[model samples]
Target: MSTAEDREELLADVGDRIRAERHARGWTQAQLGTRCGLSAKVVAHVENGQTSLPLYYLAELCCGLGVTMSALLSDAWVMPTRQREERALTPRQAHILRVAASTGLPLSQVAARVGTTRQVVAARLSESYRLLGVSHLPQDERRAAAARIAEERGLFDAIESYAA
Candidate 1:
């Protein structure tokens, strides 16, 4: 194939992988776009292979989809089955955990964004750490540990609709 054809084929394959991930999470394009700070139109264009996206946007999509850049690009990657424990976290807990883990925001800021007090945010985070079985770690390491576990289990994938 010509270089142009090869590039188009690659884009199409990547787009298919993206769409599969999104579908596995049961998220609409708009919802994924919201998580990634892009518009649904942009997501649609990417999924349809109608346009090439910048690496930055692609990275954002991976984050939003809770997949690694390498996973998204790899032909050998497959969606892993989620365990029951992965869904143990309530939507609220998942949202709070997600924001806390991903944003690098202070507790106060996180609380404000989640519409709760700092104390509540801390409490919820503690609860999350326990649920994720990371409470045994030092307090400082709990959040990062929980985040890593959550991401691995696809807990950050489909954020259920909740008032936040």
Candidate 2:
């Protein structure tokens, strides 16, 4: 279990990452809000850590930002309670993401091999990204975003390399 303070810190980080991604795309809060069917005030709230949006709205944010929900979340999405360290992706989730990033395989095909449906795989990937605090950008964009974050954290080498 996590302490309240831990949760707050995680949400704040999530908010910061969202703001960074928005800025990376050169989008104003109003512009991003318009694309996500949110008001500028709502966007401000989300970006400033004043509030947390529902999962569905976060998904919309991913779509509006042209990133995968996973790409938007990054690795700091969760911190282990006992170890007080970052969470690592499960092997299955990592495999799916690496495959998606490294290859152009359709989610359905990936699903076939992974023994899951496309929707499930997508949902899992999105959840994994949320766990990792990764964004959901297209492969190239996601790689760049992940690389930048990893570099800042001194984790570029440890972070998984996405296919170009």
Candidate 3:
């Protein structure tokens, strides 16, 4: 069995991966929350590592994030942040961000992965950007902006390096 410290560390690692994935997609916690049928506060809790990611949401999160569950759980999945005040992530948030940004999968397919209606996915994505401080752009422009953020942060290259 794992010690409490060990468990905390594991949770922290999971949070890190989630945060990394979120940043890779340039999503706020609120955006991820919409995709996963969760609240922003809950999303923040997950990202901050203040609460453990429940097993029940694990699959939903994986589906939403567009990443294999194994990758999220793996130790090799590090995505360190430059924040002076650090945070972690909830599985749901991570999943939503990963799937929406990384997968390039169709909306219906993504919804299928999460066992939800495509309408829900679409609403979540819409609400996500709507909550932003900045004005929303079209999908392609938003994706390009996210890609730029990822590149500036070196998140994609870091993940690739770990994969190699």
Candidate 4:
């Protein structure tokens, strides 16, 4: 295939993945678009592979979909299954952790976004660390460790859909 054809194929694959993830969440294109601060027309064009999305838009889509960029872009990527013995985080905890992981914002800022106190955000993150079995790490490293664990376990992937 020519370079153009290769690009088209890649776009189609990405579009399909996005569509599947969206459908799995039972979200309409408008709903996904709303979450990503985009228009439904943009979502439609993306899903149809009729347009090229900038990296920012793609990142926004991944955030809205609660999936990693790799998962969305890689044909060989598989969603990691949570182990039976692992404790599941509450929806609020998951939300908090997801924000904490992705945004790299201060706990206070994260609290503002989550509509709670910084203390509450800290407590929830503590709980998430425990649940993910990363609390034993040093205090400074706990958050990053927990985030890595969550990402590896696909806790962030499809989290929004599952929480809903």
**In model 2, which regions exceed 4 Å deviation?**
76-164
Model 3: per-residue Cα lDDT over 1-164, one tens digit each: 66988888777767767777767767787877777777778767776777978975555555656777888887576664443422222233234434667776777997887667888777655543343311267676654454444445443443433323
Q: lDDT scores for all predictions?
A: 0.85, 0.68, 0.61, 0.84
Instruction: Give candidate 2's whole-model lDDT.
Output: 0.68
Worst 10 residues of 3 by lDDT: 85-94
Q: In candidate 2, what are the lDDT values of residues 34-153, reduced to their tens digit?
A: 999988898888877778668877887778877776766766443222222365565556656655655657789878876779998787677656655666566546633543443455
Clashes of each: 0, 19, 11, 0
What is the C-alpha lDDT profile of model 1 across 1-164, one tens digit per residue?
Answer: 99999999988888888888888877899999999999999999999888986898899999999999998887679865533344467778888998898887999999999999999999889898988899999877888899998888777665756642
True lDDT of residue 46, candidate 1: 91
lDDT of residue 18 for candidate 3? 73
Tell me which of candidates 1 and 2 scores higher on TM-score: 1
* TM-score per candidate: 0.49, 0.44, 0.45, 0.47
Residue 133, model 3: lDDT of 17
Name the better of 3 and 4 by lDDT. 4
Candidate 3: TM-score? Answer: 0.45
- RMSD (Cα, Å) of candidate 2? 17.8
Clashing pairs in 4: none
